[model samples]
Target: MSDDRPLDPVQLDAYFALIEVSSLLRHTVEQQLKESGGLSYVQFQLLATLGDAPSGRRRMTDLADGVVYSRSGLTYQVGLLEQAGLVTRAPSQEDERSVVVTITDAGRAVLATVFPGHIAVLRELLLDPLSDDDVEALASVLDRVRAHMRSIPPRSAAPRRRAPTR
Candidate 1:
């Protein structure tokens, strides 16, 4: 049988603090991205990731997994980017069912324009407060947590089953 108990105070505090900090960070970054380049944070992330790819392209599913956005949400954002001429999407050369997204010259230009301000805001809001050791530990801890979370199905998708009998 599993333990169905509630979290202890320490766990509760940590959980709340993590939630609050994530909310604040996301809000601030979104505002910064919007003001700087008129792009949502997710859009900027998608563009940046594509820009860094060797061919300025990646499979749609790869992009979806690289960011926090859902696959459907990424499709919508990619549509907006395509309309703006910032990116192009086509059937993957290797797999017809997969899509490949490529950052265009315009996309690279936007990233170039936004990079400075983005770095400044990130340093100010997220990095400046952390010492070197703190930053390393923070990355390590969050990376582990993210991997663990990704291993589980989201709550909405989790299977529902009847309780077991002895």
Candidate 2:
């Protein structure tokens, strides 16, 4: 089931570079989110997603999928946000079994506080060194890779099966 062939030098170098850069970027972003808004990266993502939605609301399952997070983890984060008065959870009127999350005004205010710093960090660490052409190429490549990865069933769609006992 395994390929015997190893990655070529170019592929190995690119893979390592990508992994390192992604880690660095996420670490910086996490720090910025925590410092500016007292939010974790995941919490910021949830609020930003809801804030960008047309109605400032989304179903729990949809949020999990959109954020590429586990439903249980998303639930925990939502609970924290609810406790902080940053968001609300309510039953969906259209679907009795579904719960919807809506961002509060306070959440928007946090976004406003954090976004400027976030953008500045991104610009300084990630984008400033890139040429316009490099930026466009990177965006295009990432978009395609993301779409391909997302074609698989997301964690929110179903629970993982338990392993059979020996």
Candidate 3:
């Protein structure tokens, strides 16, 4: 009367604990963003990329890569931020059809106010006791997770297709 269900206890417990920890830490970071930055976790990620880019800007495609979003999805997010005046979009000089997104002064202000608390929350929640070796090992495992899951690109973004001119 055995069922086909496979609940290997040891494996299940380890996986469940890892996921619980991940979610707990994510929630802590998100809470900090709301309290200090008034932004969501996704918004903070977008703002952080824009903050680090040259001229505080990057192509929509590039932003999508940084945020692990589809190009269209990131465009929509950027549109929302643009409407809020936290981001601005312009035609890329190097590629007329591609859009460049820049963080606005207001955006930077929010980041400046929120990012410190965000990092603090992250450290307190996840990193306080982690050794340098642990961090490197975690990074290795995360990279493997991404590779194994195919959740992110296995390769760079597909090259943009040029429009055919008449």
Candidate 4:
């Protein structure tokens, strides 16, 4: 009998490569955003997310998730924006425990000014080197990977059972 245990080699390689590339790409984009827009990447991300939200506002937790930041980090960033008069936070009508973050007119104006430059720099860093066909192929592959990931069941954080009484 052959003793070959089951393992997903392709998934393992893809997962590792994704982790490495995500970190590197994020850092590179962060540097570009800082230099070109004079805005930290987190601030730019928050403004963009807020602009995309319905009513130009989102629960603070939603904004935090969009930017991959902790709740306190989002609070601090929003506090800075509030000080700059670029954004406002108010109580959420839908949920008392949640705060709604909305971008102010000044924030929208700044985002508009920075948008074009951001697109140009993104192309320069990531897409300029790839041909249309290559980009399409990469996009297709990524879509497949994302779909596969979505197919997997979410991890269950089931509570542990206490030892049975003797």
> Top TM-score: which candidate number?
2
Tens-digit per-residue lDDT, 66-137, candidate 2: 988988899999999999999999999999999999999999999999999999999999999999999999
Which candidate do you rate higher for TM-score, 3 or 4? 3
After superposing all C-alphas onto the true structure, candidate 4 shows an RMSD in angstroms of: 5.5
RMSD of 3: 5.9
Q: Write one digit per residue (lDDT tens) for candidate 3, span 1-166.
A: 5688887999799899899998998898888888996777777889999999878999887787777776766777788888889999999999998899899999999999997888788788788879989999998998998776665453445556789999
Instruction: In candidate 2, list every pair of residues with a backbone clash.
Output: none
Candidate 1 at 17: error in angstroms?
Answer: 1.2
TM-score of each: 0.87, 0.91, 0.77, 0.70
Candidate 3: worst-modelled 10 consecutive residues by lDDT = 150-159
Residue pairs in clash, model 3: none
lDDT agreement with native, every candidate: 0.89, 0.94, 0.84, 0.80
Q: Rank the candidates by TM-score, best first.
A: 2, 1, 3, 4
Q: Roughly what TM-score does model 4 have, to 2 decimal places? A: 0.70
Estimate, for each residue in 60-90, the C-alpha lDDT of model 1 and write its tens digit: 9888877866777889999999999999999
Query: On lDDT, who's better, 2 or 4?
Result: 2
**Which candidate tops lDDT?**
2
Per-residue C-alpha lDDT of model 4 across residues 88-129, encoded as one tens digit per residue: 999999899989989999988888878887887668766898
N/CA/C clash count, model 1: 0
Q: Considering lDDT, where higher is better, how would the candidates rank from best to worst?
A: 2, 1, 3, 4
- After the best TM-score superposition of candidate 4, give how far the Cα of residue 97 lies from its true spot, in angstroms: 1.5
